[model samples]
Target: MATHSSVAHANLTVRQTLLHQLFGDHHGWLFERLRARLGCPSDAADMASETFVQVVALDDPHSIREPRALLTTIAKRLMYASWRRRDLERAYLDALANEPEQFAPSAEQQVMAVEALIEIDRLLDGLSSRARAAFLYSQLDGMTYADIARELGVSAPRVHQYVVQGLRACFEART
Candidate 1:
């Protein structure tokens, strides 16, 4: 008399069991490998746990033939994300420090702004450097295509194309 919810719960339990076993078997090895490369034990451990989380989200984690390779790839991506977030935070704090005291954003607003900037960075990730620059100039600085072209040393048409491409990238990312 198992309901559909019960069946789904059972299936999820099985998947969790398999993932837990995998973690139990290789977590130490993965942690040590990350530690050696990153030179920080705590960071390595965090990445290793995040790696397992990523794998568990995969549609077919059991199908991986080279678990270590898969683990390494996931952990590396997590490490990169951590680095990006830290670098972005540092830049944001520096900018805040330089702002006029009366015009400064509140602490909560600063946190929200940093988070928004991080998301914007993620949304723009696949663009060429120039395209990203063009988009940022147009959107953030309210620059015209002609002005962006002059600044970037490109043709106005080229700048427009970059802006269009960047818009498309953002649209695709959103949908």
Candidate 2:
């Protein structure tokens, strides 16, 4: 029933003029809210800008009715991503500190490891304690199945099964 031009116009997001006006009106308020929630002014400002990036990428950003709510929600997700990054960096630094100084990994390897750590962290959420421990021992500490079994007081095959369960969870998350 809709005309092609009407559908095309509907597909268009916020025009430049409206985008500028929206930023001028809402950016300061959004930054303040993010600052209060994040407890860091610099991080809050960065997240507010990222929120506008998210808005501009939206398919129907002009359809938003509650601008403050929408901005805050987007900024909150950016804040979480920032926190996740910091956590990954800290963990990577700790891992490096424990390694022999002569065996430093390449930057590419470090980046991939950190990303894998984040993915494993996400996948391990909601798993039982034993299952989580099995995966971490095998993946992070580089323990053999027999070693994990001894540490966990379970059979070696059980530890293997636990690791498989964790891997299956990660695979399911990807698909």
Candidate 3:
């Protein structure tokens, strides 16, 4: 009487032997047909071996509609895999070719932009509340001076003065 472990071992051995037999018996026929279609021995052998391995692992290998039909399906799948790989390679090469070269900002430009921002912020902070709001509406929000005047219920001249004062103060701080 064999133990459960021994029975499982036997079943595995039997499956391996069946796989080897299937490969030996059908490999030549499968390879020849694939080679004729693919025009490459290495690819043909690989596809044919893969097909047998798939077929043997099936619960009912003998239930296949036709052996040649199954082999043809496997061959087509292999060709599709090769074409997909080629497509991915081409896309990668195209992306690499079209990418722009990377560069860091120049030190002078970085310093100038940062200094300008700081000066503008400082000037805005020093502004009277109403004047700062009017100036911010014109410069940052792109409102016209007349629009800022309407929103603040002030004269357009006052709005213009606020914007000019803010700009002058910013320039003075920067210098």
Number of the predicted model whose TM-score against the real structure is largest = 1
Off by over 4 Å in 1: 1-14
lDDT of 1 by residue, 43-134 (tens): 88888878888888899776878888888788888888888988999998998789899999988998999899888888888888999999
Best by lDDT: 1
Cα TM-score of candidate 3: 0.46
RMSD of 2: 4.1
| Residue range 1-175, candidate 2, lDDT tens digits | 9999887676553376667888999999998888888888988888888899988787766688988888878877777777887888897889898999888888898888888887777788768889889998998799999999999999999999899989888889989
TM-score of candidate 1 versus the correct structure, residues matched by position: 0.85
Error of 3 at 37 (Å): 1.3
> Local distance difference test, per candidate?
0.89, 0.85, 0.75
lDDT of 3 by residue, 17-89 (tens): 7667666766798899889988999988888877876787688554555667776787687677666555545
Candidate 3, after superposition: displacement of residue 115 in Å? 46
Cα distance off (Å), candidate 1, residue 99: 1.7
> For candidate 2, what is the TM-score?
0.66
